[model samples]
Target chain A: MSKYLLDKFLYTVDRDPELVERYREDPAGLVTWWESEMANSILNCHGDERSTWLAFTDEERTALREHDHVTLFEMGAHPFLTLTLFIAMFERDHGPLEYQIAYGKAMEHLTLPYPDIAT
Target chain B: MATVCAVIASTHHPFYYRASTSTGADRPPFADEWVAKIETFRETLTKARPDVLVMVGSDHFHQLWLDNMPQFLVGKAPYFDANWYNEEREFGLPRMTLAGDEELATHILRNGLDADFDLAFSNELRIDHSITCPIITLRPEADLPIVPIYTNIFAPPLPRPQRFVDLGKAIRAMVESWPSDKRVAIIGTGHLSLELGGPRQFGEHGPDPEFDRKAVEWIANGDLEGCCGDVTLDSLHLPGNATHGFMDFMLMMGVAGEGQKADHVDSLDLFHTMEAYFTWYPEGVPTP
Candidate 1:
């Protein structure tokens, strides 16, 4: 599981607002840096199937859009950070509720049932 | 000279309500019923007229981070502000302030250290939904000042359920020793079972209603030993990721005092999360 990546990503973002702002300013550069600085080390040391994530083609990296949130979640990303990243990336475009809905959808993808209670 | 002591507990999450609309198919069944139950408990709290509240809940990466999480952190600030993020505002939660009892909080910290519990103290702490939502529900008016105690239920190396109960006992002793005539109540807020961001995040088998019911029964009977002895970490985590929040209930049991049965118990099974409330009266008080 890439819980290490997810946890580190969440921890850094939650604690450092500047990192989040940098990410907002340059999503592609941040992703590239994350791949080189964070993900590469984790994958190299842990040696998981995610090793393939290192050699992503430029087109593949470009395709890594905001909608890939569920993919990240399924890959063992922390839910709080996954949602936080999603919000940071797309909250302006789709609004806040969209992120919440996306989280519910991602949780559904994980097979966790939503609580049957009114808002 | 502390007077009345009561335990108010609930399970809350920001996303639980955010994803669903107010009406139509999005609304879960018996939602109004759950609200009614909370309202009833709110009325019960108002009748008690507690001067101060000792709120026990866990922090969700708000005040503490993975690097410096404390097993037990007490707020010593005179005023605790709500950590309402923009995301939380989207769910209709407002940012607000609640009065904090600095003296009682300091006493609890000192007494806990004296009792050999290495407790962490925070002079400035922002509260998340874990306790804030319950405060809004149980004390919407925020009339009573609060002393918030944060337990480390999110991070690893979580204290044993028994430790929580023991901490509760320490808290009880501290509150009772206060040289004041103020009425004090303890509010423990958390879910029975919740698998947030875990592998079983969307799994139906994660929430066990039977387990929740049995837990309610144990609390109602004031069977702290039974709960501590029977409910293992594996059993709780097996049902959900954040089941560690159940430690809050154990803490509540400790505060309720020994042999003091819950005069009132109410529970609502919210599918993936079990919301429960229990009220324990002080010794020799007849249920009114």
Candidate 2:
């Protein structure tokens, strides 16, 4: 459960317009390509400085590939990153705040003591 | 020495920029009242007649990342390019450029490190909405040079609520001791019982109204002991997942000093979160 890696994917994609569109249009393709290419790259460093060992577990990969926010939340992926990225991709399809409200309702069954987001 | 003219604290709601500016049917029902409240709040800073602003806010994983995050950072540069692409996309926040008070930033960094804060300094920084929201509402001209101080409220292993208070006190002292004729208004923004991207988010009111009520009182009355006694890194989670942002308010409380009542206070109950505004005049309230 590499929450850090999960957040990196969300953070990296959320900031780039092209990545947001690509992830929205093709989640599985983006996830596969991101994992194979961008996941281990040090954000503030050059490409050659990228670390070699950072890889997401199968569950994390599946959650990202499916854009499953509920599962992402339960897995301790940062909720803010997940929500922001999801809203960017999907909010246009729904009415004002419809996507955000629905996103929360989906997690209504979950109680407090929500998954720890510490990295 | 620089005079501490006004110490202000507020909730940095990103929606305010869009809400207050939208016209006709595009504006939300609550926009009018929110604008009125902000106008009144803006007056507190305006009457103080500040020459420079010391803005305190946290980075929302914008420039600072987990790979290397600074608990407290000071932006020391000639200018700061404000708002991010994501902020513009999400909040309709216009891109801004504000002049940086490098002299004040240098003083804070030098004295802050000597004071054992181990502060990090950024030569070039793009500020997010936490700082800009207040600028839009209070100083829309974006005219004054500013020294931006960022705290780490979003990430875990955060500095304790008491630590925020201590830093606030330290900041106030640093400004007061600076050898300058400038009048500095220290402004910081944080949340009050907010829940973002969680089950209780986007509710009719903030997720925890009770917490917001107590938080307002603690800040307005400058009750640092009561606030820190009840608030901790662990206890903050109960009010709302994102309530740690409240520590920035505590930091402002420290600048206001313990038991010093705020000169101006107001609040607005909005859908997602409550907006609270406070201003303290260390040198008595200025007459308009």
Candidate 3:
């Protein structure tokens, strides 16, 4: 009935810088931990109606690790946080210009007006 | 009787540093001049010596989350703290505390509910820049006790602007009914026009001077309908991420009394954000 895991994952990473760092340090390990937590919570009868983590396929995990934003967006990740994650990733690797480019692409995907990047 | 009712509109986060600090490095060109004006305004507030100040501001997703965001929140805590984190700490604002007026706040909650306004009460609300920045700049000593009423602007299904005005009226009524001889001042903190965390987050796409000018004029003139009526969600959203802050201004104008004239108006255009300060004198209140 709900994609709680995906929502919680995106929301947590968006609001918590430390979690973002953990995810950046080890995406696979982070996802594994999340899956284990979900399993433990479900066993304890404290789970939501449905967990997206339980339904996530191997290909989806690969896409998440590969930074395929479109795939994640289609899978129901929050658009704003998706864009924020993209900018954060791009900024770390290729400076501010690449971050702007990533922002432009994210805006295009979200159908927001493209911004005139201030020089 | 209330001694003063003012609207101090400002950009909350990054722009807060512009007023709190003396340095202008990496800030907009108008930073120094704006800081000077705010300092003068602070002097006026000090001279007023209000016993209790009711501050209206909106939370920026720091305290509330998507799980349960309240439209209107009143702080009932005895002390309000600015629990800053990350970028908020960059402003170098020391851990600040403002005495809270629990009695007045409780009365507001009761009055708001009685007036058909469902209000959320918070005993542990941690304020963000929206309220703290203005306090640090205008009332650093925190001498006057404060009552904070938070309106929800970040999330959808935001209370209509008229609702905010009605809430202000409710608060005014509560203050009028109180038996105490305390002089109260109501200060609304927020921006006129600006965007944040959107596509133009880093661009010079806003502070729409035309819109800001009209808004300030409407507020100063105490024209509630002109300021908040027919304000569409699309219009607010299109302007910028945090343009919803205008709701706080509407609440302040409502409290200042309808059709009352502004005794003083200080407006500054900081390119990306327009800041307006207005003090309205209700009938028989001699201007200080």
Candidate 4:
């Protein structure tokens, strides 16, 4: 059941808006379709010495950013998805549920919290 | 009776990819994770013994990376491997010999494009885990043939989600039209998460039960629109590692259809939900 459950978890978060917001003023027009996994993965996608994403990294963060566009793509944060961060900070919190359940094991594997595991 | 099985996609973390490893790092740590993967993939291959395995997934800069990457790319190859290199880790590489069903694959591509879905092609690109993981799960040893599909989740000029859905419909038509008598196995792989990177780590390893519950709800009941949001929905995460290959899954579903009642497999065994779809025909239904 756990394995089956895991698959279900993959599917649920894979396609749904793991993060979003709905305010009375905006109503239907304001529903933010945010994919938490990409945001999470992007957080960990630091750049190496040779990177296509280096130019995008700010000077202060350069030594730390390992920032590469190609890696950024791998983070699942496509250029098209750049606006999600804004959606997240502005919208309601998706929950601690996906994070809560998978966090422990994820930590065990040394797998960062980039892709909100439980979603 | 003839059949062609296929796999689908969504966003996935290729451990060898830059985001998964260190910066300025050219080579990835391969052997450790891959050998382990090959070891396990063998068992599943033994269980669902099929004539051919069709692996459908999205493409990154790997193939087109060298040659102007396209929004959508597909390949019919005799062998597939991942030259995945991690700057930090030793990219333990594993090469697998895959079989190609050119007739079926070509038909599906042509039809999908005929329906106006800009499908691209390459004879020389290697595939990532998007296809390999499921393959490893079933055929850990790599003694079989595979059909590789490319998607546009990562690059631009990608087809719209609904357009991909239509591509799925075309795929269904192409599959049903195949003339060979083949028992095929298709596995759709991807993540079920929208956010990647930063503090949002879903934490690697094991099933996240809450996320698992929501995933089940979407699949079991057929809430495509509700689960996926408006088909017209667009955002940065649209082609996320989790959602990247989703349309591929939908395409397979369209091809597999609900008429055949697929038995959902247990998920805990692996990181993905391996649901078995059915296409069993009524004993007397005369092969269509």
TM-score, chain B, each candidate: 0.90, 0.99, 0.89, 0.67
Which model, 2 or 4, shows the larger TM-score? 2
Give lDDT tens digits, candidate 2, residues B128-211.
Answer: 999999999999999999999999999888999889999999999999999999999999999999887889999989999999
For every model in order, what is the iRMS? 9.0, 0.6, 8.7, 14.7
lDDT of 3 by residue, A16-74 (tens): 66766767777888667755664224322345654333445676666556666656655
DockQ class, candidate 1: incorrect
B39, model 4: CA deviation in Å?
11
Residue range with the least summed lDDT across 10 consecutive positions in model 2 chain A: A42-51
Best by the DockQ measure: 2
10 residues in a row with least lDDT, candidate 4 chain A: A1-10
For candidate 4, write residues B136-172 as lDDT tens digits.
4455455566667666655434566665555555655
Q: Candidate 2 regions off by >4 Å?
A: none
TM-score of each model, paired residue for residue: 0.77, 0.99, 0.78, 0.55
| lDDT (tens digit, per residue) of candidate 1 on A12-106 | 55445566666777767776776666654442245553444534445334433344655555554445555555566556678424544545655
Better of 2 and 3 by TM-score: 2
DockQ of each: 0.13, 0.87, 0.17, 0.03
User: Order the candidates by lDDT, highest first — what do you get?
Assistant: 2, 1, 3, 4
Fnat of candidate 1 is 0.10
Model 3 chain B — which ten-residue stretch has the worst lDDT?
Answer: B1-10
Instruction: Count backbone clashes in candidate 4.
Output: 87
Please give the TM-score of chain B in predicted model 3: 0.89
